[model samples]
Target: MPINLFKKSHSRQGAERSLYLAYYFRTPTPTNPVRYHTALVVLPSPSPIPLAAAAATCAEPQSDESESLPAPTQSSPTRARSPGRATSPLPYVTTATKFHAFNVPVNENGRGRVTWEFRVERDDPGAPNTPLRLRLVCLLFIGPLSQNVGDHKLEKILKKTNVEAKYMDEFPKYYCTNWMYEALQLLVDEKIIDPLPCSPPDFWEVGGQYADRWMAENHLQVPYDLPIPCCDRAGVALATPMGPVEEKCPDDETNGNALPN
Candidate 1:
C-alpha cells in the first residue's frame, strides 16, 4: 500500500482499493469448502504485483495458451443490492483483511427470494507481528436510522465482509450490520468512485466513474455487483411444464428431469 494514497483526493480509491487488496493476501487459509460465489465478489481491480511493494508493479499481463484457464464464477447466498456510488457510508478497513458473509434467499422455494454476494478488502498487509486481525461489528444504530430514512430496503441480516473475515466470528463471537455504503463513502472522499445513475426500476443506482480504475490498473474485469447484470432474461421466468397428476410418464425411466431414486 502506498502511503500517499491516504490523501483526501484518493479516498474514493479506498473502496476500489479494498477489493483489489485481497489478491495480494494469503489468509490463514480456510478448511471449509471455500464457497464459490464468494470468489466473484470483486475487490477493486488491481495490477498483479509481485510480493514486494518495491517490485515493479506490472499491469496484469495477457495469458499464454499453455496456462490452464481461470476457474468459473460461483454464486453465494450472502449478497446485497449495491446502492449507487457513495450516497451512504461504507466501512473502511485500515489494516490487512478479507471479510465474507453467507446470505440465503428470503424464500427457500418462494419466488421473490434473493441471495446476494458481498465482500470488502483491506488496504494494508500486516507483518507477522500483528498477524492481521478481524472483528465482529454491528449496528445498534440502524433501527433509529431506518425510522428517519423511511427506507427498509435492507434485507434481513445485512452483514458485510471480505473473504478472510468470513469466519472470524465463529472463532470468537461474530455478527455485523456493516453495509456497503460505508465502503462507498471512503471512495467518494478519495475520488476513485463517483456516484452514477441508479438503473431503471431501482430506487438507487450504484456505480462509479473510476470503479473500473482498479481493474484497469490491474488488467482485469471490474468487479460486479451481486445478482450480476445479465442481458439474457430468457429462462429466468420460463415456467416448468406440468406432468399429469397420478399418471406415469411415458418415458419416466429414461427421462432425467423426472424425479430420481
Candidate 2:
C-alpha cells in the first residue's frame, strides 16, 4: 500500500486538512484501465491535535543513525496507532485494495464494467488488539446487452489462473464467480494481509443512495439515467469533481489527469 500525507493551508482561514488512501485497480481492455477506490475510516472534526503539539512531534530528536529506534510501547494521548508499525496524529488511517473487470463487447455496441473494493479500518488506535473493521463495496454497470458480461469475464479470469480450481470445494454459496470473494481468497494466500473475517459487511446496495446524497449536498446535478455509482460517503470529501461523460475517460492514460495518491 502507498501512503501520502498533505495539508492545504489558507492565509485567511487557517489550514484546511484532508487525508485519504487511493487504491488502484486494473482490467483487460483496449486501453489501460485504472480505477481509484478510496474509503475514509476515521475523521476527527475540529482537528485532533494542536498545531504546536504537531510541530513538537515533528521536531522530536532522533537517536543516532547506528542505533535502531524502539517500537512504541504505549499509545500517545494525541496520536493514533495504525495497523502495522505506523502512528499518526491525524484522524485518517486506513488501507484498501481494488479489482476491476471489463466486459468485452461480444455483439453489443457498448461495454459493461464491474469493480470490487476491500477496505480495512483501524477504528480504535488506542486499542491495538481490537479487530480491524472491514467492508466490501461493489459497483456494476450494465451496457446495452442484458447478459451479465462482468460476471462472465470474472469467471474466465479465475478459471484461467486456476484460482477457482483450488477453491472449488469452498466456493461461495451466493455467487460462485463473485469478484470480491475470489479477490479476498487471493489476498489471504499472501501472508502480508491477515486477520480478515470470513465475511465483511457489503455496502453495494447503499452505494447509490450515498452517491445521490453527496451530489445533492455538493450542489452537483445527478445524471438522468447513469448506472455508475458516483461517490461513496466514506470518501466523499476526497472524491474527484464530476464532469461531462464526453470529457471523462478513466482508461485513457494520456488524459493528463493523474489519480490522487
In lDDT terms, which candidate is top? 2
Which residue pairs show backbone clashes in model 2? none
TM-score of 1: 0.19
Considering every candidate listed, which one attains the maximal TM-score? 2
Model 1 residue 200 CA deviation in Å: 18
Candidate 2 vs. true structure, TM-score? 0.24
Candidate 1 per-residue lDDT, tens place, 1-261, comes to: 111110111011121222211111111224322111111122221221111121122212222344322221223232332222211222222233343343333544454443333533332221111211111100000001112211122211223223233333243222121223343333334443333122111101111111122222332221222111110011010000110112222432222121100
TM-score of each: 0.19, 0.24
Tell me the tens digit of each residue's lDDT in model 2 across 96-207: 2223322221322363322222223333322221221111111221001113323234333334333222221233231212443444344335332232322312322223
Q: What are the RMSDs of all candidates, in order?
A: 21.7, 20.1
Off by over 4 Å in 2: 1-98, 107-177, 197-261
